[model samples]
Target: MVTRRWWQKLYHRSGSSTAAAASTRTISPIMYEFEHLYQMAMEEIGYAIDSQTSSYYAYDLEDAQAAVQACIQLYNQLPITDKWNPWAEALQQLQTRLDALPLPIN
Candidate 1:
């Protein structure tokens, strides 16, 4: 089950100061949390991409696939925005690379 994040809890809490600050501030807590999570997801995606492309070392396909799946999950949890465009592109590229790999017959 997906649990609510700290920002969600904060946003939902009664009589919260963040609600007021969010309205007046240019960068709301929600945006801050989104950016933080986006950065983390991007980092994980980058690592998987890099490891797969590097010529010096062998990387685990399962691990890279897992990382991509995790990033996709995080992306799905976040709100809709053009900010996610890059992530969508990166995910596509990573998926393409993964798809090129030969599958083992069961």
Candidate 2:
């Protein structure tokens, strides 16, 4: 079995920590609420795709794909104005940790 990198473990650990913290602390209730709304929006998008595919509506499929892509692009564009933009910060930390590891030379 292959071993996972330290950064991978760190990423997972950080996510777990954030989830736990979010659950206990209600400082940003609106942000937490938005998370639930965002999840529901994603689920609706998935349902749209399924409906389009099952109905074999070419236009509907294309529209659904475009909507999903737009949503993803918008998500990627979210500004990380501070050092604690959780997702971006976590990803950057993971990359830094991964890069610090020495690779085995063949």
Candidate 3:
């Protein structure tokens, strides 16, 4: 008889019901909340980037700035140990786009 590793039970293999049950385990409430907020921030960032790239006459720099600020706020709210460091790259890209926009002369 072959002994299975503990981690292997979480994956679907050999049509085992145990794998399905393990995989369906509920996520922690904190993680769920973080995921929801992160998605909203990403959508806002995506919209801002799209607006900046398009040739629309009514592009609002303030909206883009707000979107980046929202994401930063979200990042700051997370605990240090729970931080998703990879997300910093997305923030950096959005900042680059905002910086590239020309300032309006008053």
Candidate 4:
């Protein structure tokens, strides 16, 4: 089962602060688009897991995980042109947390 502590860390590290700043400071359209894409990718990963595709097939799990990792890597690599780019930093933190999680045993 998912733990509250994990969720809390994820929420904080995934740039809730950056999003708030963006709303309060009139962030650019391009930054907003990046945020939207990041959110969509996260939602897709959740949906895939919820649908049991990952558990029913080993390849599905690997593919989904790889997709998420790729997105996170891309976000972390984006140039920090403005305050909105803090999302990239946040993505890096999230990726580190995910990497630290223990793998499930077969």
Best by lDDT: 4
TM-score of 2: 0.31
Q: Which number leads on TM-score?
A: 3
Considering lDDT, where higher is better, how would the candidates rank from best to worst?
4, 3, 1, 2
Clashing pairs in 1: none
Superposition error at 36 for model 2 (Å): 0.8
TM-score of 1: 0.41
lDDT of 3: 0.51
lDDT of 3 by residue, 1-106 (tens): 0112211321233556434644686755454445544454455445555665555412345544554565567667777666665766766765776676665333
lDDT on C-alpha atoms for all candidate structures: 0.50, 0.41, 0.51, 0.52
Clashing pairs in 2: none
Q: Which ten residues in a row have the lowest lDDT in candidate 1?
A: 1-10
Worst 10 residues of 2 by lDDT: 1-10
Model 4 TM-score, all chains together: 0.41
lDDT per residue (tens digit) for residues 10-102 in model 4: 446557766686778675665555565466446534544554534533333343455456566555555676435466576665455445433
Off-target runs (Cα >4 Å) in candidate 4 are: 1-25, 53-79, 83-86, 93-106
lDDT of 4: 0.52
